[model samples]
Target: MSTVKRWTVDVLVNDDEGRTYAEACLHSGEADTRLVGIGRAKLNPADRDIPEIGDELAAARALCDLGQRLLVEAANDIEAVTHEPVRLRR
Candidate 1:
């Protein structure tokens, strides 16, 4: 059998002292699968000011971290059920 579900993610950024912090929240619809991840980027005082660039970089980092974590959890679950190591596919 096959099924489909929808997941949602929201990212928010905060700026302080040339630093941008982004937090990503992922909701998997299931009660036990909510996840949150955070990432940070710093702007050099000598460089040109570009808020959008910083926001994009920070948000992308946060999402990548979140994806890594989710994959880890999935691997753990697979190992627990199968009693074997999981070699994640590339």
Candidate 2:
């Protein structure tokens, strides 16, 4: 029988839509500066072996980028709230 391994990762990601966004990021690297997970987003078992080559960047960059996006989004949201712009439906 095959064994399953699970890891615990703590990422300071914004309250995103849910795992959908995260999974999308995992699949496509075209994630915008939106809600993201930052810091120690994940914890891999010491015994587990991770591949060297990958479509994703290093964990450090990944987390930082996520964090940055979250910050940017927050700033923009705050601006919108302060400005209180009105929208018109076309």
Candidate 3:
């Protein structure tokens, strides 16, 4: 049997204390697995004032963190079921 599933990911950014913060949330909509990742980028006083750039950088960092979390969760799930060390396949 074959199956197809859709996952949703959302990234939100906010500015506070002269820094941009981003959070990435991923929902598989199955098994109640919801992953969240956070990132921040400080606004340098000497740097150009570009809000969009800060937002982009923070969002990218959050997504990268979220991806790492997903990978770790996958490894843990595999190990839990197989009772063996996980070797992630590419």
lDDT per residue (tens digit) for residues 1-90 in model 2: 995544333432322211111211222124332243533222244433333211132445555665566556666677788886443322
TM-score of each: 0.89, 0.34, 0.89
For model 1, what is the error of residue 47's alpha carbon versus the real structure, in angstroms, after optimal superposition?
A: 0.5
State the local distance difference test value for candidate 3: 0.90
Candidate 1 vs 2: which has more lDDT: 1
* Model 1, C-alpha of 46: deviation from truth (Å): 1.5
TM-score of 3: 0.89
Query: What is the Cα-based lDDT of residue 3 in candidate 3?
Result: 90
RMSD of each: 1.6, 16.1, 1.8
lDDT of each: 0.88, 0.39, 0.90
Root-mean-square deviation of candidate 2: 16.1
Q: lDDT score, residue 50, model 2?
A: 32
In model 2, the worst 10-residue window by lDDT is 15-24
